[model samples]
Target: MTDIETRIEQIAQVIGQFDDAQVPRNIRTSSKEAVEQWLLNKNKEMDLRLGMTASIMDEIFNDSNLPIHFGPMCLQVQTVLETLLNEVRGS
Candidate 1:
């Protein structure tokens, strides 16, 4: 897979591992925005770095106070990325 494709998949996998109830409200919202921005820009290096940072932050901090729909938003972003990857591969 290409670099863009790899980053997309990596972000998707990271997002998939998140537990909605454990994520902070701000992080949830920002994660969705980050995914959307990554989708639009597809800056492989930057996107990969952002995804890795988010994953690290989430692992270090697990907040359950504020509720957010981060899981669903992530799944949506993942689906879009997967679709785009498939299209790029002509599959």
Candidate 2:
């Protein structure tokens, strides 16, 4: 895989952490959908995919039902995604 694809995979792995049963159903489902629909959707441009995924991560972070600990984790993933997006755009 290319560096960008590898970074996206890493972000998806981080998002996967929210898939546990302990997380709210909607949050878990949304996280999964973000990875499947945004991050892994190869049909989209890499920068567009990263931007969309970051947007979804931001929404997931803002969700009231999200666990407190997950907020920072989501932010971290979003930050990484945004950074990757910027790099992709720069190239």
TM-scores, each model vs. reference? 0.37, 0.95
Q: How would you encode candidate 1's per-residue C-alpha lDDT over 3-88 as one tens digit per residue?
A: 76576666656654553657665666655555565433455554354444445335334444434555455445545554554565
Error of 1 at 70 (Å): 14
- Weakest ten-residue segment in model 2 by summed lDDT: 3-12
Alpha-carbon shift of residue 41 in model 1 (angstroms): 3.3
Candidate 1, residue 87: the lDDT equals 60
How many Å off is the CA of 53 in candidate 1?
A: 7.4
The C-alpha stretches of model 2 lying farther than 4 A from their native spots are none
Kindly give the stretch of ten consecutive residues in candidate 1 with the minimal lDDT sum.
Answer: 57-66
CA lDDT, candidate 1, residue 17: 52
